[model samples]
Target: MGVIMEMNFNEDDKYLLAKKKVEKIKGFYGNLTSFILVNIILIFINLYTSPNHLWFYWPLMWWGFGVVIHGLKVFEVFPSFGKDWEEKKIKELMEKEKNNKNKWQ
Candidate 1:
């Protein structure tokens, strides 16, 4: 059996919190860069190998489909994490942390 405990956060509660936020941003930036890189590589390969007049069109079609998927993630259409929501959440978290530290000290 595992023991669970809840601890209080103090003014020095900076390490984990800061690390988590940095990790989150790192993850998003990594995903965005990787996504763009992969699509660009695919587009370049298709463009270079295209032999027919409409061969370049094939990559465009495939890229269009990828764009739709990326758009959904960016806009958060279904997961409900649109731009405003994300911004508000970040602001709220910062305020909450500030409040907590003030109260603790």
Candidate 2:
């Protein structure tokens, strides 16, 4: 009885952890998509305006930095909320789940 009860508790914990990680990845990807769209619109608007008004180009350089950051996040080269961190969390959750299954058996 004691062993079975412990196994159930562990499995529940693993499920909850996995759920949280999935939610986090969803939110991160949503943000990333939105950021890309906004960057595109801003660039188009800037290029459409007059050539004498050179104020927007400076912000474009900053925008390029943001693009680089987002690219890194997308590629999983950096620890992003969607990619690296989520992968690590999922691995940990799976290991926990596997251990719980072993205990049940």
TM for every model, in the order presented, reads 0.40, 0.45
| Local accuracy of candidate 1 as per-residue lDDT tens digits, 1-105 | 122223456766767756765675566566667667876776677767763433545655676676666657654576657645665666677777777788889
Tens-digit lDDT string for candidate 2 (1-105): 122222333888889977876675676677667766776777677767855565565655676677667566654565567544665676677777878899999
lDDT minimum window of 10 residues, candidate 1: 1-10
RMSD of model 1 against the true structure: 11.6
Name the TM-score of candidate 1. 0.40
| Best lDDT among the predictions, by candidate number | 2
Give me the displacement of residue 25 in model 2, in angstroms. 1.0
Could you tell me how far off, in angstroms, the CA of residue 88 lies in candidate 1 after the best superposition?
16
CA lDDT, every model vs. true structure = 0.62, 0.64
lDDT of 2: 0.64
Alpha-carbon deviation at 26 in model 1, angstroms: 0.4
lDDT of 1 at 45: 73
Error of 2 at 17 (Å): 0.8
Q: Which candidate number maximizes TM-score?
A: 2
